[model samples]
Target: MSSPRQQHWENVYSTRQADEVSWFQDDPTLSLDLIARSGISANAPIIDIGGGASVLIDRLLDAGHSALTVLDISHVGLTVAQKRLGDHAGRVTWIAQDVTAWHPPQDAFALWHDRAVFHFLVEAADRAAYVRALDRGLRPGGFVILAPFSLTGPERCSGLLVRRYSAAMLQAELGADYALVNQQPQTHLTPAGNRQDFIWCLFRKSAT
Candidate 1:
């Protein structure tokens, strides 16, 4: 069952180049900076959700973080990334699954980074499920970093509707078990030569 957003992303990756995506960046420095500043172990496992075709994975590998995973619903996007990374493909694990249905491995990632994924949930149940999984999947005291369309950001992407969220709104959606640590603004350059704003937030899992 392809979600509307999933279909939209698959179509985008099938027809557009990496440089044509709104989230495309030669270096997603803002996200990487937040991750590095989180005081987490450099070698701790990190997973990038909806990481399709993002250069962040390349940057992560270049930074000496060996345990990295990229999960995306688009096979074409993953293919492009594999081709771009070349021999380095062997170093990163790639999983093709709709994140809402995927389960985290036992004792898995220490950090989870998701940009522009959760906003597409649109439904309370889906969003709740995603957060529930995040809470359960992350190791105790692990970190979760996410970026979503701001309340003032674009309402659509690649011809599909998107739900926007504010920092507080998103934190509430994740519930009280996760503590919101940091929030910042990010400007995204779209392939069509437009800029969009996103709110990036970081959360830490509470022992409770």
Candidate 2:
């Protein structure tokens, strides 16, 4: 039997089209821009947490990034993306697992990206596990780009409660070892024509 968490997302992916989802972005323009500005090499190993069927990987491949990984709890979503990628899908490492419980390969990535996922982790223990995975996966001096619901954003998303964050709160959660590189406020317009506020944070892990 699948966990409720897995089942919830599987159901969502099975029923929704990429364009029908509120999180849909025809082209992740902002995300692409931020990543381009990260100064990492095209060969840098990068991972997209909760990337389920996101076209970001396609764009990255088009941009000539050789190493890419996408992780999501919903196997259905990954399947959709793989089918969409056709033969090119083999270039990507796909992991279908819960982020909180998943173990990271040590120093595996030079940049870690997450969008529309962190806020769903409303539990302290889950958040702690996430941090540990992050620490283990990212190389020293790596970049972490997170887009979370801002304090002014909706209290809930996708019929689930979310933990909104202020810049300070996010910084604290990352600890002093991470140096803030940049931040941008986004007023995202969902595919459904609803508006959601978001804060994009870029941090550089200490080279220690």
> Which candidate tops TM-score?
2
After superposition, the stretches of candidate 2 with alpha carbons farther than 4 Å from their true spots are none
The superposed Cα distance between candidate 1 and the true structure at residue 35, in angstroms, equals 0.5
Displacement of residue 63 (Cα, Å) in model 2 is 0.5
Error of 1 at 92 (Å): 0.5
Cα lDDT tens digits, model 2, 43-140, are 99999999999999999999999999999999999998999999999999999999988899999999999998999999988888999999999999
What TM-score does model 1 achieve against the real structure?
0.94
lDDT of 2: 0.92
TM-score of candidate 2 on Cα atoms, chains taken together: 0.98
Each model's lDDT: 0.86, 0.92
State in Å the error of residue 61, model 1. 0.6
Cα error of candidate 1 at position 204, Å: 0.6
